[model samples]
Target: MNEIILKFSKESPQVKDTPIEISVIDVQPDYLYKFNAGIDGIWTTIQDFSEENFCIWKPKIDGKYTLMIQGKKKDGKKSFDAAAKADYIIGAVEEDIIQSVNIDRRELLQGEKLSVMVETTVKPVMYKYWISGKDGWELIRDYNSENEFLFTANEPGKHEILVECKTIESKNNFDDFRTISFIVSEIEKVQITDFKCLSTELLTDKELIFQVDARHEDSRMVLYKFVKIDNKGKALCIQDYSSKRMISFTEREPGSYKLLCMAKDMYSTEDFDDRAIIVYDIKPYKPIVIKSFTTDFTSPQTTGTKILLKAMVEGGRNLLYRYMIEGKHGEDSGFIRNNSFLWETKYPGEYKLSLYVKDESYSGDYEECTSLEYLVEEKLFKPVKIRDVALSKDKNYVKNKPINITVSADGGNELRYSFIVYKDKEEVEKINFGIANWVNFTPEQSGEYELEIRVRDKYSHKDYDSHTFIFFNVRDYIPGIIDYILIPSKEYYMVEDDIEIEVITQNAKETLLKYCISINGHPVESTEYSKVKKFKFTPKVSGKYNLEIYSKNIQCKEGYDEKKETKIYIHEALPVTNTKIKSSLVKAKRNEEVTFVVNSEGGKDVCYEFYLMEEENWKLVQRYSKKNYYTFIPFISGTYRLLALSRSFYKKVSYEDYDIFKLEVN
Candidate 1:
């Protein structure tokens, strides 16, 4: 006999008035269980355990009791097999009450299930529920040992529920109670959303079926009515109100007709919840569907390679297929009934293959069409791009200077050109290809610049037919004076001479030459600077004149390109034009008292200086003075020469004119 043992977890002594569940871990399926309690060393059967459920016990008084379970032989009689017992202490009255009561659904529509669950602070408690619904307050459920209840919401309105729970051994009405409110909405009327017919599906002779779509929240039985409306404004009932959602007809009428459907619940209050109508034009039926027209191709093969391209036709009768495949090096397009085509790919590039299909009896262009991408290639040849062409010019470059580029292309077709400029290895400007064969560019900064010129035919498919580039550099711009010229080259300039001073400048392109001229320590003619490269002036009086030239570029403000100064003397014309030495004799003896006076024309306060030749040397007979005449007496002279010089009273250029005379003494 196996020893029987009872496991009691009600220790630390459970409440006296509370019920405890007694369950046995080891029990035979063909046995009846008997639960007993010990009273003064004697075991008394307190409750009988059913095979379907465990036995529950509620202690009447506080005491130490032994709880035991006996395994029996049959369901009717007690044939003891093994017994197990566990001692338990029953304290005073236990206040096992409900901890919380909650309704699983807070709001629901009619015909939906709502559950109320009750939880207690301890197990083995009784729950009861009272509901105030559309029928007013009533005891919906009596007290039960179960902790929850589920029921369908039949009535519509705000339903208030009251739940109460108490210990199984408690004699009181309730230990705890809770109140909760929820609303049960009325069942929504059924709405007929749409009436549909599968026109593409095949049916038997004179057979038609349309599906009806309806919406509702109620679980009640629904009925749908179908009506047939002809183009003549006549209506006929095709289907009466029934539980069927689809209507079937055997009418072979071949005119335009409207099919209408009305849907509603069996117990709805309205005449018809919702009605839907669909226009149907009945005609002789023939089905043709080009579900998909697809093309299949294998990888590319070498030259003279034959590729079998197939067109996949899914659904259609007597369908004709057409194919078109195109690439740069090869292309094929044809229309045929055969599903496969043999293609020889001569190009090595990406290709797109299109397949089109149409039913023989169909009037439309095509029923279905699809495209496929495949390539037939060999070892890839070099890319024949538009390159190795160049645009060049033999010239120096400067900043902010514009230059023109002329493309020299020998293509047979119309040409186009594009220009791109890069400064310091970075692109700064670009012009796209167009019909024009020339491009103009301006350098913006001083650096290494590259101009790339690309050309192509106007209708060429490639990016360009030829392209070339040239590298060049730009030097920094600094204004400079080239040179200056004094017009009319001459030894000396008279006081009234019109002097032309022309200055030249070597500055940046598009930069003008501004001149600032000054003479005699003052700004002359043009005090302000201007674009005056050539300046002319007439000096009224004779004086030493200072000529200064300042040339500058327009981009500068404070300084000039170069500063140049030159000194020029402008004198008055010779005032004394003719002068002569007048003597009493051409030859005179020593101390002969020869009177040699200077007589001159065109003179004013003239001062004369006299000189005589003696011993192969000229000697001054008298210094310059206000005296115009002089006395000459030769002392020892074989042949004597006397000279007279005259000038203006001011004698600006020493002496303007002079005369010489030959005198002899014998």
Candidate 2:
């Protein structure tokens, strides 16, 4: 069993109809209790508590309330009871209602004072004032009987002024609050003036200075920020927190720009002023005069030759060069972005070449020009004069006898000679000499022979001279002949390859003879033979073959005949095995070096030739005698192919190998 005790907050004092607290102590840990408070002795349950010992009670009517508690112990074996009495006086409730809220100014500048007041219907025991802004609500004043508040507006924008009234007489409901809105604007206004650059038009690589005047009416220190803006409204640079009124900057390039000056008070950033000044014609340095104009060749140059005109300049950036050619008939002019000009003379005349250089950075306003005169001479058409024509041997001719005719000419850079031999007015043989003065011929047929020699200057078509000689008596003697042969042009051939055979007789020019040719005992039927004979033969298989030639009736003799024999060998051609590149990619970047290698099998000492494909033709790039690889560096971007030709040392036939590569520069 446990004992219970009861307690009252106001044991013997009289209080108004306010809230009071009652408690029970020294009870069992797990006991149940019932509490009652009323004027009547009849117990009306107010609370049933199992573990709590205290409670708050508000009396509605004036009465001597009986505070009682009844409880049982945890064992349910014993019961207990306790009682106390308290007096409460009923009074009139206070109605806490706000009548009005007012402010002296709705809008004011920062650092200015604002007055706020609040009025309530019932008298409040205390008043609280709060100011709410971006930083949230803050209590300004909390005191008894204070209905008004005054404070400085420190921050800008809308602010809330809240006032709370409280009366302790109204138990649990005695607070009245109201809020009013006001605005605080910035106090200082800054003005920017005298915004100017010292020089709007400046030369390149020169400094530019800008100045501005700024002030504020509130007598606060002014701050400045300068920005250089380009024509596209993009800020090139910004100088922040500048204390000085002037700024200096240098630009190496020339362009259009603007200087923006912004001024603000040091105390506030909310108010500021800005002004812009346009700067123009930032130009390059002045153009230098053309010091000299000269040509590569001397005056009186021959027609159809190129002459180079060069102009020397001292100082100018991005210069535009203009060249003018003033001839006797008309004038030709053009512009180039370089300093050199090439001129080719088409006609013989005197002309003036003028060079004008202007600075493109200044819109071609500054220029320097100079001119020079020169002449072009025409090529002369001089006829070739033949001093004499003579024969190596005497004019009387014999059969199978060799004779040489020589001519002397005076004219032109180059002279051409032609020889014609006629037997009884029928022209039999003609020979042309290029840059040579003599020709050799053998009189095979004995007759009255007329030989004519003609000479001409290479530059003239109709200016020529000739001489004629007549041989009166002709006779026949014992004839002797010599034979020379050339096979495959270099004495080498391949299987299935076309072979050309040429035969030359040393002492006979016009004697016709009958001949029989054979290859490996296979008879080749050819009836006639000339002084120099050529024929083609294609070998079908690979082997060694003996070629034989037999000629009869030498120099029209009755029983004079000769026989000759030669041997030729033909072999199979080797194929190009592979073409490789050392680089990782066949496509490369411009200006990159690439290496190409070629390989061949079954060839002794291969010769390699590299070619570049240009405009549908393969141009020979280089030839390697005994090497197999080549290195190439491309300067431009385009599609390119490398052709590698592998050929043997003695054969004209080659095996072609190629690979394609691409370059990208941009």
Candidate with top TM-score is 1
Give candidate 2's error at residue 633 in angstroms.
Answer: 65
Candidate 2 lDDT by residue in tens digits, 372-403: 78777785533344656677766436778788
Tell me how candidate 2 scores on lDDT: 0.64
lDDT of each: 0.67, 0.64
Candidate 1 overall lDDT versus native:
0.67
Q: How do the predictions measure up, each by TM-score?
A: 0.30, 0.26
Write candidate 1's Cα lDDT for 395-487 as tens digits: 556677776666555533566778888876678888897777676667777777877777655775655545556666664555656465455
lDDT of 2 at 193: 56
Question: What are the per-model numbers of colliding residue pairs?
Answer: 4, 0
